[model samples]
Target: MILWFTIVQIAVACAAGLFCLIAGLIGRRPSDYTVGSLLLVELLLLAQVVIGIVAPLTGNPPTGDLLEFWVYLIAAVLLPIGGIAWALLERGRWSTVVLGVVAISLAIMLWRMQVIWTVQVA
Candidate 1:
């Protein structure tokens, strides 16, 4: 994993989470802006996944438990995905709330991933 990119990802997730949380708490429904931001986050995760795969091939494998790191990566990608579906189904401020929570969780998961990557070398 690229440390710099991971840091940027965390920042993006946190910022997005705050945006969603505020929108949700203010009684606002989902909007294109929020949805677009969510999509951006998804795209970034996809990029991270690619980088993760390539990093190992290039001899930069994590020093930690690989399976655990993989699990975190999968969850980080999936949580927001599930939240997006739920938001679409629910169609209200609660949808944004779910997204907000997902974003926050994703950030934490990514941070853990960073730690795992750095601590456990191949």
Candidate 2:
């Protein structure tokens, strides 16, 4: 994994988490901006998946166990999918709460990814 890109992803995830929390607190539904940010995060995650696969293919062994890597990747991909689904199911603050959950999940995955990267580097 690219260190810089991972850092960027972590930062973005934290910000999104904060925004989601605020939205939930204010009893506000997700706005276009919120959805757009989540989509952007997912896009970045997809890029990470590609890069992660390519790195291993090119003879760079993964930092974590293959199962761990796959788990993180799956969780990363599912966050946005879940967010979209929850947004559709609820119309207001509840939807934002769901988004907050997504953000938290994204942050956790990013941290796990970082740990994997560190293990790989060591």
- Which model scores highest in TM-score? 1
lDDT, residue 3, model 2? 77
Query: Where is model 2 poorest over a 10-residue stretch in terms of lDDT?
Result: 113-122
lDDT per residue (tens digit) for residues 38-113 in model 1? 7778889999999989999999888999899999998888887888888888889989988988988889899999
Roughly what TM-score does model 1 have, to 2 decimal places? 0.95
State the lDDT at 5 in candidate 2.
91
lDDT of each: 0.89, 0.79
Off by over 4 Å in 1: none
How do the residues 48-100 of candidate 2 rate in per-residue lDDT, one tens digit apiece? 88988898778767666777777888878987988977786777887877777
Candidate 2: give the clashing pairs. Answer: 63-120
- List residue ranges in candidate 2 displaced over 4 A: 120-122
